[model samples]
Target: MQNASKITEERINKGSLLALAPIGVFLVLFMGSGIITGDFYKMPALIAFMVAAGVALMINPKESLQNKIDIFCKSAGDPNILIMVIIFLLAGAFGSVAKAMGAVDSTVNLSLSILPANLLVTGLFLVVCFISISMGTSVGTVSALTPIGIGISQKTGIPLELLVAIIVGGAMVGDNLSMISDTTIAAANTQGCELKDKVKMNFFVVLPAAIISIIIVAIMTSGYQSASTETYSYEIIKVIPYLAVLVGALAGANVFVLLAGGVLFAGAVGLFTNSIDLWGFIGAVSEGMAGMQELCILVMIVGGVIGLIKHNGGIDFVLNYITSKIKSATGAKIGIALLSSIIDLCTANNTITIITAGPLAKEIGEEYDLDPRKIASILDIFASCWQGMIPYGAQILTAVGIAGVSSVAVIKYLHYPIFLLIFGIISITVDFSALKKKKTH
Candidate 1:
């Protein structure tokens, strides 16, 4: 028994450190290369992760090569990873098809014509926030809004990457607080809080940040060059694709179903407009799926590797370390926030990070008499803050790709996430007496 206990302790520590190694590798490769070259493009994120993921395998026990390979394969092919891959493919197809069909340009021109120049950034920010709240996913919101943001930037002479960042920031706000968000669900469930209670607590904590972000975006874009806008021919029918997708998503339609409907609408419109022949449309769809291959591969690698880490007790090790270090309710909250932020950095997926941290956070919450809602809010806030700022994150990467600019450029102009960090810190340090009172009622 003594020998077994000693061995178990050693495994816990070693596995915990090994689990962290991939994250360190990723950060060094991506951030180090960017720093060396003075360009964020110096290292592609997927390549860095691929290398790190391979390294993670080396830390596994001296097992049969086939067994290890099988382990990796299983993680790489998890249902969640496959789902994200499919979404990436469908989204790519829809984006391409929509663009080819002129919906993107028409939507852009229409947006520019409607929103006044002064309210451009403010309007975009609000729209992104609202969409993310309704859809409960930042990636979905970013996909739907980024092209529009890019169009707005081109038409108005604003920096395209910066505008994309604005949309990304707003989307993250909703991702953190939205009732239907996966992050929200994970946090609430882990902390034993009702979803509604968590959302209410988070609403107060993030409200100041939201308002501040709007003010900052408005001020920054106040000098935006206004171009003479022309009204779109207004393909009212084409607009139905986005409207249907949005409404269906809000109605809690399955994501795959929602995406399928959008894909069908976009493809049908492409057929109607003669943008491409049947063969051409099929080719576009195929190419889109091909485009997502790398992303899909990466997701599988991460999921599988993370699964092994969990199986080996790395997660438990970390949770024990953090929980043992907490002394007060305030410290517990801060620790939960920190835990979620660190996990977000590693996963590059806010929802997954929240899920990883949720159970641990709940135990801490109960021990400290901390409100489950507050704990949930803390997890959501820091995760969103970190995820929004990471250049290699899905939302930022997609936005950068669509905007055709440097990720650094986008990061530099992202004032909203920065403001949010400040607001979150303040809220944590000083209890908002009024907000607390409102919540009690």
Candidate 2:
């Protein structure tokens, strides 16, 4: 009986730090080469992931080589990962068709004509926040806005990296707070709380961060001047495709449907305006999908590597280690935050991290008598914070892929995630129960 109990405990706590070495290997090879060369582009992300995937295959001698390959292939073909790849391909097609049909230019011209130069950056940030909240998917939000951001950057002389970072940061705000967002839904359900209650708690925690981010963006762009002296013009007819996609997303239409519709809509407008021929539209789609090929392959490779790490017990080790350190309710809260953060870092997917960590967090919260609303809020906030900042995350990857900028360059301009982190920490360390009571009175 004693030996059986010991075996169960060991199984529960099973994890190996060596299982995580592939990630370290990737960071060192990718980021290290970038640092040494002073250009991240020198080391392609695809090569780094390929090498990391090799390392993952080589580890865990207990598993047969064929089994390891199967694990990698299964993870690479995971439904979520495959869906993301499809989204990337579709986003590329839509962006290409829209740009080819002059929709991007018309939209940029309309935006520039309406918003003052100094307020363009701030306006873009706010618009993205509203759209993302309505859309409830950060990747979708980033995909839709990145082309416009690139257009603005070119016209305004603002750094492309900064503009793309703004889009990503704003998207993350919605990812954390949107009622329909996967992260929000997962967090609330895992914590056994109502979605509305989680949203209320989450809004209060992130509102200050959003406000500060707006101010910072305003200040950063205050000195901006347009790089082009030429006046911009727009054709309202050409802008319809972008408008359709935005409206459809806001209405909670399926992303795949919206992208496909956007592509066809843009092509129709192009044909009507004689902006592109039928062959030209088809070529544009091929071009767009080709552009996304590298990113799609990199995402799949990363998925495989992450799969091997999880299979080898990397995540379990971290979970056990963090839970072991909790000594109080406050400690438990911090532990939950840390767990979410680390898992997100490893997986590079916030929604997945929340789903994986939610049960453990619920267990910890129940033991410490922590509020479910608060627990849900923390999980969403921290996961979003890490997701927004990580270079490998889909949000940042989508932004960079669209904007044609390096992910590392954009990280420095990501203000919202930093502010979100600060506010998240403050919410945990400082008790707001008294403030809630005072407000009620």
Give the per-residue lDDT digits (tens) of candidate 2, residues 44-102. 76787788889889898888999999998998787766766776687778777887988
Assess candidate 2 and give its TM-score to the true structure: 0.64
Return the TM-score for each candidate structure.
0.67, 0.64
Backbone clashes (count) for model 1: 2
What tens digits encode model 1's per-residue C-alpha lDDT throughout 1-441? 123234335435443655667657876887688678755556876787778767767765666656767777786676655655666566666655655666655554455456676787788887677657655568867877887776777778887877888888888876765644657655665565666666666676678878887887787788885674655465655656666765665566665666677777877877887766788777777775676576556556666666565555566566556545654556767887787888777556676566556656765565556666777778887888888999878889878777677778889877767877776777676765343522322
In candidate 1 the C-alpha lDDT for residue 94 amounts to 62
Residue 338 in model 2: lDDT: 90
List clashing residue pairs in candidate 2.
none
> Per-prediction RMSD in angstroms?
7.0, 7.9
